[model samples]
Target: MTGWDISPAGVQSVVSNVRDAADAMNSGITLYGKSVEGAMTSAGTLSFGTDGVGGDAAGLVALALAKFVEGTERDMAFLPLRASNSANGAVEATNAYISGSLEQAWNAQRQATRAPDVTAFLEAARKKAGEGR
Candidate 1:
């Protein structure tokens, strides 16, 4: 009992804080990219799209379980057979890629909508002004 200096609750809190920071780091990068993607992308807090990372991670988990369940050879999707895919790499590239692409697409849509055809606008204005003629 003397050798043990920390409580289980303390260890749990540390784990939670680290997980939150990592998520924030990933999210911040996405925001920075969104800023650059202003014209070619979108900047938003949320979206309606597939989450490749989550899905892929889930796939990874299933893969690991399936491997353990089937006791078969390691597939490329779940690589590093022995110790590579620890399944602890919480966020997967698959979900991130999907989410990122949709964000970009959404931004592109916004840019397109904001663009106005000045010539057409002027023509309409002039036509309306000369309506009597």
Candidate 2:
């Protein structure tokens, strides 16, 4: 039999660290968003040249920049949510362990390992029914 050991303090420390990282990442994201907003505002009136070709090139550049910003925002939006979920899961699991519920659940699963084989039981029943028929 294998033994399991868990430390509540260790789990708490991990949770704290994850939360701190999430906070830092969120702050960085907010700052980046502000910077991008400022840059976009400044670029709004930018002109490449009075010629049609230059105007088209400038429009293409602006469109590409906008797409890049949108993609980056979409990709980074979930970082904080994922971190929060991870920390919350660790806390919940640690609480279950401290309450002895985790052990009880493991024991229950171990006991259930001796469950009857349903396929064999079904085959036996089928054979008996066929014999009677």
Candidate 3:
């Protein structure tokens, strides 16, 4: 078995690291949300009409702006949702890792404290009891 630094301090450090990563993830989420908000605001501010010279060029510019706004709005709407999903996934994975590590440490400690021949001893005791019956 690989050596493990399965002390209380070690576990606490791991948990703290996970929390730090989560804090970073939260900050990233906030930033992504702000970006989405900015994109939406920009899309809202886009003018879809003539730009002084009302001609084919103006129409093309307007069309391009409309398309840009549509794409920006759609992308912005989904950006936060995707970032939220990614953050949630990170938290879930972290929780799972912590839980599994702690559980394995606990199990290892329990095993270390148990006699290697405990099962054999129990079987012998059961056989003796059966013989007495």
Candidate 4:
């Protein structure tokens, strides 16, 4: 027969690591946003002349930078929430594992299979961190 062994302490450790990662990511994102807040506008104003090719080039550059920043922000927005949800799920599974009951095991499996509510987790984290963003 094949079986699995799980340590609650190990799972708890993973949960702590994940939460720490989420917090770090949140801090980094906040810092990055602040640092580049007006970069797009600054870049756009680097035009050389009213009808010069440099103006068009500067506009294109600004647009590209804006898009890049937007994409980066969008891609990173949910990462912290994902990490938090994963940590929460790990804790739930660890509890179920410790209970050693068939029903709890099934519940854990269900929880694992469900999609994480990242938006809610993000909101909670932001609130906990005393951040309006």
Candidate 5:
């Protein structure tokens, strides 16, 4: 089922990415020969809002990232690796294809959204599950 079960880090990453991209796009106004004043007048301060360049870019970027998360999540979510790949001696290629997709998602999210501190959290969680200290 669908849900809004996103971590705070995820939300932050997404917002931060969108903000940064908006800044980059706004900066590009100079390349097209648009003066700061002209660009502002044309593009306006919408990039920082929810209905401007920032918003549109964020939506597009997020949708693509979600697909990445799904691909990796689903692939890893399954049991064993055989079911996910062919026996053409391409295990590495298969794993990479899956992981690379995740990497791309991660990159995009960093650009358009936030990501969780999964490594730290998981490491700590594993430690907790180990023999009592």
Candidate 6:
């Protein structure tokens, strides 16, 4: 009888770390932008709001990240208990697959959340600067 010992806490921790980082980044940018007296013009606002760099796009990305995390957490909620109680090899394989998939999803999400398109940032900044309003 093979035993699976996956920790749901461990999985949650991994996802939590990335989520925290994304939250921090988003908050920091928001804080910095707000701190400026007249840093953002309408063009920049529109760029971020409409273009695929920030604003609504970022919000949607955040929403997607949240849903992914919630779904993963729900899926793994019973995994720790199962790991401790189950003696079935099938459970072990299933746990492994779920954990592996969560890890992959985290990797993709982290990359997407952390890295913004430089071209978009530059264009937004340029437009904001040129608009002068």
**lDDT tens digits, residues 38-103, model 5?**
443444222355655455233444445556554554233221222222121123323333454544
Error of 3 at 9 (Å): 0.9
Candidate 4 Cα outliers beyond 4 Å, as residue runs: 44-62, 113-133
- lDDT for each residue of candidate 3 in 28-124, tens digit (9 for 90 to 100): 7568657655655454333344785433333444455657755654444444343443444444444444566645544544443433343454467
User: TM-score: which candidate is best?
Assistant: 4
Report the C-alpha lDDT of model 6 over 14-64, residue by residue, as the tens digit. Answer: 555645655565565457445432332221322353456565333444445
Model 6: how far residue 18 lies from native, Å: 2.1
Q: How many angstroms is residue 133 displaced in model 5 relative to the true structure, after the best TM-score fit?
A: 70
TM-score of each: 0.26, 0.61, 0.33, 0.62, 0.24, 0.28
Clashing pairs in model 2? none
For model 5, state the Cα shift of residue 91 in Å. 40
Backbone clash tally (model 5) = 5
- How high a TM-score does candidate 3 get? 0.33
Looking at model 1, residue 20 earns an lDDT score of 66
Flag the better candidate by lDDT, 3 or 5.
3
Q: Model 3: runs farther than 4 Å from truth?
A: 1-5, 45-133
Give the Å error, residue 66, model 1: 40
lDDT of 2: 0.67
> Residues 88-128, candidate 4, lDDT per residue (tens digit)?
77677667767776467557656765666756665776798
Candidate closest to the true structure, highest lDDT = 4
